[model samples]
Target: GSLEHTAVLALVLAMALTAAAPALCFAALAVAAGGLGTAVFCPGERRSGAAVFTAGCALGALAAPNLTGVLTLGLAAGAGLLGFLLCPEQALRAVFPPPATPVGTQSLTSAARKLSGVADTLSDIAETVNAVCSCQMPPRGESYDYVVEFCAQHLCQNCARRNTCWVQGYSTAMDGLYALRGALEHNGRVELEDLPGQLSTCVHPADLCATVSHGYRLWCSRRQTRARAELLRTALTEQYSAMATALAQMAARLGRAGLPDPRREARTTQLFASLGLEPLECTVLTDLAGRVTAAVTLPRTSFTPGECRALAEEMGRICRRDFDPPEVTNCRTVTMLHFGERPLYRAVFGLASRPAPPETVSGDACRQFCDSAGRAQMLLCDGMGTGKPAAVDGQMAAKLTAQLLQAGFAAESAARLVNVALGLKNAGQESGATLDLLTLDLYTGRAGLFKAGAAPSFLCRAGVVRTLDGASLPMGVLPTVTGRSTALTLDVGDTVMMVSDGALCDGSAWLCDQLTLSTRLGQSPQQTAEAVAASAVRRSGARQDDITVAIVRLERQKS
Candidate 1:
């Protein structure tokens, strides 16, 4: 290949040597070096004699009749010959190294100015707000005459030692309230007639409610209980009535402040003034009815929102507050929703699993997640078919649902996210799964149900079984989905049972009968769960698919 390449170069070189072009002279020099190499390296190679080559070039040059051209060509050829004789890199570096490019002044200045502009803009925004986050924080509170550093530890409303006192005081008060409620429940019923007789033993109203037992102070029998119960009830009633009234008035004021009247802003301003804190343009969703939600705001001073929330909760111990915990936001703004008198509930859960006829991995997936907030979410996902492939779909749906719920998504929202994720996943796998989710508020014993093409779930409360039918297409079956999302009470000792469709191969009535029988037998929740699953398996017999059952029993937390 190089030999053919050399021949083409040699032909062009010969033509160039006959003219006075610089490129031709360079070509001639390159051809001459190749000839010399061939003559020296290979003796058998036939080469054009130097005398003949020189004569031909001379004749062509004379015919051109251009003395200046002849001189230029001779000089060019000499230079090219020298280049071939020398190292290429050294020669090129010395004669034709590229020039360094200079940076443009205009572009450099513009870039610096642009960066500076952005920095200045950010600085301005920071100046406008008290504290800034990735998402915009509301602007700082306006200047206040009474409270000079209105948002922080230096508030005029609170004395310097107020916080220290408040923290310990609130905790003690809350503890007292919890003790009182526990006492009242333990007593069962109270009478109002023997107030003087009940007060004889207990020194004060606080002592009456908080004291669980006494060498005779805690009324043991109904005969001894009523008189003291009546007195304790009367005392508590007299004490808390004023607190309740204050809470109601405060709630009414908050509601009115949200109205369109011109006095609304003035009222809010005055209210915050009384509280000794500067008023924000908007109180995060708002605080009302004895429950206060401190929207995620930077504590301007040493005072923090959590502390304020704790104070509010302590105040609410006297009266019920409606606290609806805030949903999670993208800005990661921690919002606290409060509901008075709803302490997190405690629950016990049990689950059972049985694989399809011959598959190693069951096509059913069950999961339960409980967060520190006493929020619990349970999921039961059944893939369309049995085996590992179907099992993967079920697991994916269940995992997504559980994770989303833990991340503070409500049942409906988490289900929607799972539905979309399943839809996206379906592009690669044609399988779809039924999602049955239960989110329970341990505080209120309230459970929310979200289902997509799921089987009927059962709730056994006070020995009565209620079936919740979930009518919808399986996840990933439709672009726009429709499913059941409902909330209902799951009081103490109530059991919520969920199962895969395979468990109900025949009808729901059989399972209900089994549940009722188990309830009547006074079986524990774990035993009940096992019995329910066992019954379904026995009913399926030779035609079993994938059987799974999960039961959650709500119970009041022990003191």
Candidate 2:
């Protein structure tokens, strides 16, 4: 309370009322002030602001004060303090409150515009490149000119009968030469008797046929190369167009502002004020999914865990929605609180790996983490063979996959990108690896399994075990990668088991049995994974390979 400011306000009122019956005016003012204080200080009360103001006016008209004015003011102040302490809400509302205005959109619009412009530029470039690439396609097949050109440059160059075949009898020589194309294309070579009369009478007919055959093969190889290059160009153009479209969509989403609730904001503010912390700003934003997020900025203060939980519960009740615990960020002068919607489920992961016999390093790698959207990802990569070289490939694939997924890349897209990276890592030598990816959406309890030349995985629901397998080539084997994906809804206590091919050298029957047993016994994910890996190695005997096993279990999140 500003005591000096209050005194100044009272003096100003007294001076203004001195010319119009000062004593009676002062008495009415005193009663009006007391009733107004009582109404203003009582937070969370349902009385209309106009009703409170009218009641104050009525009390002023009926009451008169003289020497008892001091006692009346003291009692009013005490009652106001008591009401402030007792009321859970601490907001102060005027009789005519201003309209509620939205936040964040004004500041976000500029950034969204810039991003949209960049996306448009990219889209335009992609369209232009795609149009150009589509227009300039490589020739479909081997051309007739290649054989003639090859024969003229290589065979007829140093022949003694070059003049007879070129200048004097150019037309006859061209017909005889063109006739060899059919023979060479059909049989991959031309015999002496297959040539026309003009070419049959050459100084060396056998040599000419051989030369034509070689030239045709060369022309076919060049055509194939050009076709491959064209295909690559088309693929790149499509990728650019897709990237531009994704960016544009992202910008549009960012530009779309979520609705703000003024009632929720006021309640949140008052809640903080009741906790002895006056919020500098309070905003409640709701997304298209109907999830509410309340952001409150308050003067810097220490918040304990219990207080945060209680505050979150209170806020949830105030907004009539369930919210996760608040994420707190403190600055020098203020603390920011953000409360989002809680997920429906939680997934736990466990992994176990072992190197091959006589090897110290394992060729299999794995990574498990939750993405920004709360989707849990499990990546298991197995390289071609055991040892350091294989370890490098496995690690690279797993790392790249994790990073791409975390950066919002789709599962298939991330796997394709990792394949291209591995293929380009080494120039001449061939390298390949199997990639197994499992993604679980905690909010929806949907699980997706993506495999690239990986071994079959087992899904254990209740007491039954089901095998998930797909036919695909390993990454780095070709310029393009092939993969298979499956989606299924998961429930509480459902477990997913994944293993490398090396672990199933004997067969998948044992692995399936192991998964079933683990599920029946209700073992922890870690224990189940370790048991699977150990059983696999024991079954392999002396011819052991690099073994890796990963497990995921879904459970309902505790309230």
Candidate 3:
């Protein structure tokens, strides 16, 4: 718009000048040029094209003669006006076509630049390939200096553009030639007609043969390396998957074994020993034992009665064991002293038997039996590391703790026993296990909590959560010392949660918020867990450490 206006004004002034003074032909020419130039070069109104045009015009006008005289001034003004009025719209349109409609101008420009770079690079590669091919000497050692000289001459001719294309092109051509030569050398000479299709297409067979021969050497050299790495990765993945499956199975088995004190290693050792296995075979057999132990013990701390029962049922199925159905034989009104409330810690029991129940039952079975036998002892342990070793550690901790707790040993003494076992097993090594032992007197609901390097337990009362920070070094790390047990009392509707570090690090606050939002929208736990897991995996950006969580809710006993 500005350019158009300027053109119009210039034409008007030029016409006025011509009308005022017949002698000012130069002024008319200058004004016409200014207007035409402005109309041609000036961009859209938003641009400074019009201002540029005006400045050029003013400078031209200043150099014109007779600017002070009335006649000359009148002529100049008239010429300027005439030039502005006479400037053709058609001429302006020719100078500036309608702006091209583009999806994205910046993107198009970037794409163009990329393509241009690729094209330049390819051209250089082509030149290099041609040079190498042309310089190939025959097997008889015929001189190929002429071909090399020719390539050198071309390189000199295009020296400025050489770096961009020549180096890359030369490298690619050399690679191709090397691959061809290596293939030929390894596979032996093929008839010109019987050569591979790729080789046949090469303009220089000698160079291609040399490349193929070189490639064959490289392939042969690294074949074992590539194969070994792949085999190792596959083995590792299989081991991981097998361990996970075993853990799941073991957890179910422990749940069904309604024994008063189920010992993980005892069961594993017995299982292996029954099969005539050596001591080293114990490692493989017990690979998933600890995980199972941890999973079984998890319910005591983190599961509701209903959930516990459900888990027990699942365990029975996996372990192919039968447990006495959970029965509420008598309603005993019991007040939990910890939170000073009356809650039902129902006495429940079921039996889980494999082909043969190990001499000792798992801690989970013991806890289940305790609930039924009117015993108040719960032991929790998390194995260090992951898979086999960690699972083993956890199993040992739970087994030892459960054994001592059932024997009427105090919680502190039981924890000390477990810690001693862990330290012995992992002597001189940094590896250690953590245990959360709780010996609850079902009759009074008096709890003796022994935390061994486990995260502080949480107590939920009246919808508010409080952490019980009974911090202690995990077992296996150090010798058992005094001052470990944290005695407390529980009340009705007070939920106690104990979990492995895996569970605590499962998801972030943002992820929890998202899960909460999904829950508010009525997403099921299965769905929530799936989403949480997926989101956690995504957020983690890599395979994370193991994850586990357990929640135990205590409710008033049903009369």
Question: How many clashing residue pairs appear in each of the predictions shown?
Answer: 6, 0, 76
In model 2, which regions exceed 4 Å deviation? 1-90, 93-262, 265-289, 293-339
For residues 256-348, could you state the per-residue lDDT of candidate 3 as single tens digits?
Answer: 422221233223334323434311211111112221211110011223568436534543453444332332211122111000111236422
> How well does each candidate superpose onto the true structure, as a TM-score?
0.42, 0.56, 0.32
| Tens digit of per-residue lDDT, candidate 2, span 254-323 | 5463678776776566667667887666767776777676777677777899878887888889888766
Which 10 successive residues of model 1 have the least lDDT summed? 139-148
Residue 420 deviation, candidate 2, in Å? 3.3
**How do the candidates rank by TM-score, highest first?**
2, 1, 3
Runs with alpha carbons beyond 4 Å of true place in candidate 1? 1-344
Report lDDT per candidate. Answer: 0.55, 0.72, 0.44
Scored by Cα lDDT, where does model 2 land?
A: 0.72
Off by over 4 Å in 3: 1-344, 347-373, 481-483, 506-543
> 107, model 1: CA deviation in Å?
42
